[model samples]
Target: MEIKVSLIISVFNGEKYLRECLDSVIRQTLKEIEVICLNDGSTDKSKEILAEYSKDSRFKIINQENIGLGASRNKGMELAKGEYIAFLDADDWLVDNALETAYNEAKNKNTDITMFQMINYKENTGEEKKNDWFNLDKFDKRFKDTVFNYQQTKEFLFHLSVSACQKIYKRSYLERINAKFPEGIYFEDAPFFFNIWLRANRISIIKEYLYYRRSHENSITAKCDEKFFDVIPSGEEFFKIFVETGNYEIYKEELINFAINAYRLTLNSITEDAVEEFYKRSKRQFKKIVNSPYIEDFKKYMSKGNQDTFNNVLNSKDYEEFKKLNVNSKGNF
Candidate 1:
């Protein structure tokens, strides 16, 4: 039997790169797939370009008001009619064999999700950097590793921060848990990863680079803002479940590594709320790692800027001191 996959690509005024993204999808080596494009109120030629592709049976378009990327993805998930689901951003393109590789891996492992590596590209200079999406070095792929339950998967959940566009998921798993992207948040992928890993029975990792993440001017990931840090609330809520369940005790090391990477990313963005929120979470989790027991190896990778912020939060009497100075903050944490 042929495997059918629904590829959800959410667009919001992505006129500049929409054609190239669609071309990449339509040229996928795995031809048994449908491209579901959700136009989230694009006030550009994105809608016109998408309309042209609606003529193809393999392509479907849903025109809706500006509901944000998360809601647009949820809307696509609702209408998806495939056994497997893959998410692609309108501004990014994928490798030709990505879908075939991910789907085959999931089937062979009997896993709920399969993730692969990605390539990050600079839109202006055309410079490229490869990203190991899962840090699969932790797993022995030569053998069949049986992850009995969701808790076993949390060991790998932190890696989901790498990127959502790199993975393909089983529709039944998502349907069983009613999984959908959270609406109106910048980091919609974060909560989805947390919740899915909590419910997913098995996850397989593919180390080969398959997704290309284009860093363009208007891309949300390329831009920074206060509202972007709105994801902290959801992060806190998800982390609470992680700590309470303690299903991830074995992966504390990975969690700290994840936190450090997250900490650095937030700091580099120079957003006050992102900085403050990371400070708060790291402070709360400090006791857990104070003894250098779980994540000693990652200490070297910590940036001077991050270390400074961490120290400031640890020693400073007031959080408002730095917030008052950030141009983006205008006095808020």
Candidate 2:
């Protein structure tokens, strides 16, 4: 019984949404799917829930000490015997029949990766928002059905999704590139995904929102971890991979823009108590970028506002005043 799609789910104390998440995978129309779950030392009843469903046979569960999300996914990938791979967070669920469509498209097109969209669902208010990583508006109508890597240059990089969960990856392609998520880091997907997109020669974009990415205050996405400024390391890896692949000079502009946004995102989200320390660390990161070869070229490609902000930060090193400006704009500049 060969697996067509190995859906890897990484969980840690995710009891509240665990049942619904498992239900979605178990009910997927794609019968050849295998759900590989990593129970990363969850103290909650998550392990109990997993045991309840282990009889499904297709569900493979790994109970391990608390490893971060990246390591959990990596362990599941090692155990996966599927031809295609998909990722699902423990708190997120998939659309019924979504697997069938994505799998068929990947197989039929022989794509290295099948990219899809997600519905950003507000758990509290039930508000839905678009999470189209492909930015379909930029798609040339003639190439809609074509393999993107063949039709577009790294131009498609402009809308690349840093999150890995929304896409279906060909197992062989991943193995060939020796691509594995870096473990023990928050937001590990950014660098892992950047490398995948660089190595993926053929990608198919499906416009459907096949996954529901739930939003909640408890989610660490909006929190700054004093334990680790994962983005600084991730962003550095982002740039290193590009330069190593000889794409730094070619896609320099888009890459720089992505870096700026990445930096700003983390800097803006830091908790007030941790701001001083985080700012020092972030300042070093910015200086590294500014000193990179051909970095002066980066300023020209930056959006006017971003350019000015970077200049101000480089000159004044005043994250405090920058915070004041953001406060004035109601926190989104």
Report the number of clashing residue pairs per model.
0, 0
Candidate number achieving the greatest TM-score relative to the actual structure: 2
TM-score for predicted model 1 compared with the true structure: 0.75
Candidate 1 lDDT by residue in tens digits, 1-333: 353789999899899999999988877898888889999998999999998888878899888899998888888888888889999998889888888888878777877877677778889989996544434444455424443455554444564443668788899989998887778777777767766777676776777777888987777766665554544554545555456556445554555445555544564574654556655654555445455444453354445444444444454444465443332332222
TM-score of each model, paired residue for residue: 0.75, 0.89
Q: What is the C-alpha local distance difference test score of each model?
A: 0.70, 0.79
Worst 10 residues of 1 by lDDT: 324-333
Judged by whole-model lDDT over C-alpha atoms, candidate 1 comes out at 0.70
> For candidate 2, lDDT tens digit of each residue in 149-234?
73264666667566788889999998888888887777688888878887778888787778888888667674566744777777
RMSD values for the candidates in order, in angstroms, are 6.6, 3.0
lDDT of 1 at 35: 88
